[model samples]
Target: MMLQFEGVVATGSAALDSGIGHTALKTLNDVTYLYSVTGPGGGIAVWKLVEGALPQLQDTEYFSGTITFQVGGIGMPATLAGDDQLVLDVRTATGLIGYDLNPDGTVGPLQETGTLTGGGDISALVQFGDILTIAHESTGQIATYTVNGDGTLSLSASIAGQADSMQVLQAGADHFVIAADATTGTISTYNVDQNTGALTVVDNSDALATLGIASPTAVEVVQAYGQSWVVVAGAGSNSLSVMELAGDGRLIPTDHVLDSLHTRFETVQDLAVIESDGHVFVVAGGGDDGVSLFTLTPGGQLVHQDSFADTIHSGLQNVETLSVAHVGDELQILVGAQQDEGLTQLSVSIADLGIVRDGFGTVTGTAQNDMLSGSILETTLMGGAGDDILNAGIGATTMHGGAGADIFVMQYGSDPTTINGFQAGTDRLDLFDYPLLRTPGQLMFIATEQGAQIKFLDEVIVINSSTGGPLTSAEVFGAGFGGPDHIPVDFGDFGGLEPGSSDGVQGTVTVASEAANPGLSDAEIRFTPDGGGTISVRADDEGRFDLGLPSGTFEGELEIIKTYSTASYEITALDALQVLRMSVGLDPTWGPATPENLIAADITRDGMVNALDALAILQIAVGLPTAHEAEWVFLDDDTDLSGITENNVSYETGVDVTVVDNVISTDMTSILLGNLEPV
Candidate 1:
């Protein structure tokens, strides 16, 4: 996603440092603090991170004295000694210095200090567990040291290189250090010894000139799609380069992005990576009087998202450094504005860069607003919640705005896409991409049986409206299309139900079955006329239905189409035993066996409730397939349904019914098959 302009904090007098700006953030007991070091002239400045309507950097403090001449700094919130105290580590031109951060938000006395023997200025500082690494910018020297429990430092190892900016990438148990040398114009990767904290040369890429990266000043690492990536900001060429960090410590340059006229990336100095939602965004600041944002794809591509260049309003005057922090659900970036001499606190908005996917399949979104673009062949986009934007590419596309206001975009060559759950006033059809189709008045809104059809040229977008009504001009956003010719709203054959039709008839059908008082839940009843066609309606849990019939006379037979719950308490082995007694001529007088009870006991539908039916009922109780033909039996209330014995039984699925004056009333008795004592 793109980075939107948020609030900015001025560094004030703290901006006088000559080197590139660097920032670090640490949270202690829910309170966040920002540590900033800008070049050679400044020491270390700390600000209390205040988050509210907008993030504010207030109550600035300084760890002054001999800690000046610093170029970069890092905050170790958890030290190697296992103490949960924050240690502020600053890299000076001469060496490295560490300070204890007091709980009162004050800088304590010097905890430890280390002197570098190599002839070079300290450029960057990064810590991995107990190992701390420092990069020498001028002489290209790298040093590794162990941070002692008592806040003392011991040299672990040293390597020769023009290290300008360094980043440590931890891949499981293996740790690798990447160094960017601005002077030598080279990027180096070194393997770190986990136990001894020593650096071993793996490989180096001296192809900055070949890759158009003149000066690789800043470097940052981010993990996406289970792979690690190193994003380098080249100040010499005003560009950002992405390289895949292979697991074996090899750097493979994949893709790079240069500053364009639309985005200001002039002389990019520092880079910081932060993940918003599930997207990985890289924020860069440089000589340009603005800040730019880019998304790093899993394939190591730098896709430019957005940029803001208003120095007066954004306070991003020659932004030198950036560091990201998560303030609750909000992602805030502390920008070190070198020219403004202040830090700008910017919050990350959920507005993502355009998400483009090719081919087909369904693309679903979350509760947050999302931008989805589908191209090539049939594709389906379903926006579950929030205000979403769905871009219809080519071929057939199905879009559903499950909730919230959504925009359905139609470009040239985009086949007609089906739009579901489209609220007329809330959701709009975006036809801005079409040169001929501009204004809403230019488009034709025709109401059909399938819903509303928004037509322009040969392209058509079908909207599945809840009310099945045509849309208005207010539901479209664009310029003038072929227009001026209005298509009248035609409800046509779907205007509504006609009189005397089954669907037009309003009546209630309640089923009384052998399931206590509120009989047979979730039963589907179908009314088939003697002529042709069928009308169906399902009863609710209370076994009642506001019958659905067509708008015409219905001379038909009503039958139970379907029933629920194959497994019921009535169908059990105990019921099977009762049926067994009746089959053997030993009538257990739970009640006088009626014709309905005898029909229900006929599990095999062979006109007899015998020992075979009892055996089937026992099988049903154990969840096994039974020889029962029907799960339920429904018969008409009035008929020769009496005196049906084991030798004589007859039944029909449907009962006779006729609609007079566009209304029909009928009732049926239901029985769960194989249930002998269903009371």
Candidate 2:
């Protein structure tokens, strides 16, 4: 069972003396209240339980009048068949008392009392509907009572046995009460009739004594692994025993575990069983100022998981009483401590035994805050959603904190831990246990093509940025470190198309002609670095060029210059006439006028259009040599080409391109010399 120490609160009333031996929970209306019973010369105290923003017991002195009882009484809550109000049943050494409990968090008058004639001090009691069972410590008798409408108890049946603690267990249609007898060191099971409160002894044995179990103080029934099992707290021997309940109410001893310093099960006193998410967990509070948790496996074995000691501020000093309930969606255990004189609230969760059994493998957590760690083998830990803490064990481990602010912990002698999806400033790296690596400045950061790495004395952690960006010192966290620093490393020249290929071919530009136009052959591509130097290259006959621009920080536009080529002539007199007509207000014969037509008509390369530019285009069209500054004017595909008549045609020649993966591919529309056809 995964157990977490939530918090603790004191039972505020001074009337209740120390040694809180028993507690009972009563939920009325929508509020739950806790009643704590102290030892001899002590009184009962009630607190309003609030499970809101913080799980706590709100101090509300609902009752001031103290009822006297020998030693401390065991209390439980019951509701009348025809009434909505709750009733408090208390079994003391001498008799049983029933108090009227109002739904408004108030204690009413004492309704009824029943006297015990010939039994010893009542050790434990349990109520099922209107039937009540009490165990006598000295007389060795188990008595059954019928709670009448007026809260009076009528004796129905009695059995002879030494019983210390008792709990009700229902299997199918038969009801049974399992009891632990410390005086005889025996665990007994008795069958009960539903209609009339009567007990019939089914099986009783001193089998626990053979297993070194002495003075069993508490017994609890849990239904797990598709069967009923009884858990007994061996107080004298400082151990716990588990027995399998057969169909006929026979208690067959199955497993038993002794207390150790790690488990802290000294002086085991009480056991509370909880079933959640298809798992059964047993919570034990011991007199050794400790609390231990266990889970039953499908194979009927008990697995001890976590333990908490009072030395850890757990508030479990002389813990005598424990009660569990579902507070909101969380299973909360209320612990009553005698020596500490307070109540500690603990949270319980089912342990992922599958992961534990695997020894080393991929482990995934739930959306709630998880405390997950790895084993001493190659393991992978993934904290799915909540803010989690992941401990890297002694193996090459990979950790991914899926979505929340998480902490990755590293200890000595573990293999290097690689962290993926590590959010800088959100997630943290804990290297406190790493020898001599105390500050961030002491570590060295190396930049690579993949990501960055932090190394310190044979330890290396690879931080893989999910965004595929550069990793910096801002992602490193440790003690004695100031705010995040932008650690700049020389991220060597980004490679070319192939991996590790130099950025020698800095850029590439391809020019393609219009649908029915001539292929752009032997085009000129020019690249100007940001600082004001130009490098020009000639494309092949196919109009494709691998720009060998120098490798550096070049982040601006580059100019492309291609003068008119007299060798290629697709334009004729008809195209020149079309451009001349477009120079005037008339529409060109080849197509409707557009901005590209006006740009093609500007043969002199000036921003304006007139008849002289058309004359130069006509001479070039007929294969007669002519002087022209620019033969082909390139425009970006997304540039606005509308609303442009002659003089307003401001040609946009620069194609913006940037190197990403060592290569840049740019495509531009080619406007050949005086090809007035629509481009």
Q: Model 2, range 1-679, lDDT digits (tens) per residue?
A: 3467777666555546356768777777888777776654565566676654234443332222334544445555555443433233233324554455677655666543557643325667777788878776656678888878875667888888667678888776778898887767777778989788777887444444445677888888877655788888888978777776756676656556667656666888888887665556777877778788765544344455568777656678888888887566666788877677667877754333222111247878777556566554567888877766666755677888878767676644456888888787777676644443436788888866556787877678888766666667765553344211111111111111111111111112254321111233444445553433234444434444444332343444545445454444456688778867767867887567777777777777777777878888777766666676335556665667786777776767777766432245556665764766653
* Candidate RMSDs in order: 21.3, 28.0
**Best candidate according to TM-score:** 1
Indicate the TM-score of model 1.
0.53
Candidate 1 local lDDT, 429-510, one digit each (tens): 6554443333566667776664677776667888887566665444433222221111111111121211110111011234
Give residue 372's error in model 1 in angstroms. 7.6
Given candidate 2, what's the lDDT at residue 386? 72
lDDT of 2 at 214: 79
State residue 176's C-alpha deviation in candidate 1, in Å: 1.4
Q: What's the number of clashes in each of the models?
A: 25, 1
* Model 1 residue 478 CA deviation in Å: 11
lDDT of 2 at 229: 80
